[model samples]
Target chain A: MAITSDLRNVPLIGQAIQRLCSLAALSDIESHQIALCVVEAVNNAIVHAYDREAQHEVQVIFAQYSDRLIVQICDAGHAMDPKHLAPQTASPLDFDPCCLERIPERGLGLAIIRTTMDEVAYTTSHGKNILTLTRFLKSCQPGSARPEE
Target chain B: MQLDQRKAGDALIVTPLEDRLDARVATDFKERMIELIASGNTIIVLDLSKVEFIDSSGLGAIVSSLKRMGGRGELVVCGLRETTMTLFKLTRMDRVFQVFDSEQQAVSALSGNKG
Candidate 1:
């Protein structure tokens, strides 16, 4: 589904994330992480991509299979330079001083999304920036080594 | 969405913040803080146990509210979830505001202040 760049769209995106987590029957921590990722992604699209241009739309696609949940956020705004962004290493389960000191506002969203999901990839093509996040629901259990899919 | 207010002796307790404190709700949050300060509620404890997440705009709103309250009032935050706490630490807001692990601790600290 797609949503326009209205502030009202935030709750809708949040609700969608909740539904996805519910369907996956994720653990409490996992659910919260997913919710944060979804919110950050949608917020970035609205604040940076659309720049409050209500005429633009942020496209969200959710595809679920038996083992995985896939989410795609697509926008036609300016392509993002990933090199300037730093990855967030703060585990939701642990509080690290290094992670806490990095006060990154622009790149933290992408980093959190990357760390929480099983697989994260981004590409800019056709005047669009597409970010795809994949989570293997079955492999996310604690202490499980997720094999390459 | 609903804000519950009460007096814990000399300190005021505000609880159960609802809605995302982003650009949309920052204005309302600021207005409520200002109203509380104007009503002679000085030492304030904001129970943010219910706030799920906060953004930069929301962070700015809180800082602005603290400035508006001035030196007469103290704003202590309590019960921040991990995600919200991360935002605070990231912005160095943890240094700016005193944070407590529980509402009781926050209220007690405010009431115990000799100053």
Candidate 2:
């Protein structure tokens, strides 16, 4: 479903995320992480996806499978050029530290979302920018430690 | 959602900030406080009575604003809701900030303190 960019929309998004997380039976930390990711993603769609002069709706889809929780945030503003959305990387030692401090708040939203979710993907199709985030429900179990690569 | 501001002596008393102080509204909050500080109003009281939530970004913004005010001024927060207070405690920011139970209390505490 789609919602306007009002603050009230946050609770609806939270509810939707909670339902999916419960269905996946995620741990408290996992659910909290997913909720944080959803909040940042939705906020970005509301503030950055559309130009202020125009009205736009953000579409959210929650899909739960046997092993994963999938969330898709789609906006029909200007299609995001995938190349322009590179993940933020740590500064190299040679780079000026002051430059990092001056970076605008917009860049941190995507980084926070990526760091909180297990899997993240972005694509643009037919003038729609779809950002998908996935959390593998199974990997979080106590005994299911990381397998040898 | 609710905001209250008043003046006690030379200090500005801001109280009962309701709603989540999250990334969505941190900028506006920071700007308002910073503007007040820049207007030569140093002693400030932030009454977070109704605030129910705050995240890391929100906490960071508040700390950054406090730093901006420098050692010459004081920024004190009061009446933090239980959940909001928990965040401060977890981040150990409660140690860094002087918190009070009411605006009057904060004003009284910082009244004599000056740079």
Candidate with top lDDT is 1
Q: By how many angstroms RMSD does model 2 differ from the true structure?
A: 6.7
Q: For all the candidates, what are their Cα RMSDs to the real structure? A: 6.2, 6.7
The residue-by-residue lDDT of candidate 1 on B45-68, one tens digit each, is 888888876755566667777777
Candidate 1, after superposition: displacement of residue A102 in Å? 8.6
Per-residue lDDT of model 2, residues B1-115, tens digit only = 3457788888888753656777667777777777778888788888777665565556666776676777677888888866567556544567667888887778878865642
lDDT (0-100) at residue B2 of candidate 2? Answer: 43
Model 1 clash pairs are B1-B18
lDDT of model 2 at residue A79? Answer: 63
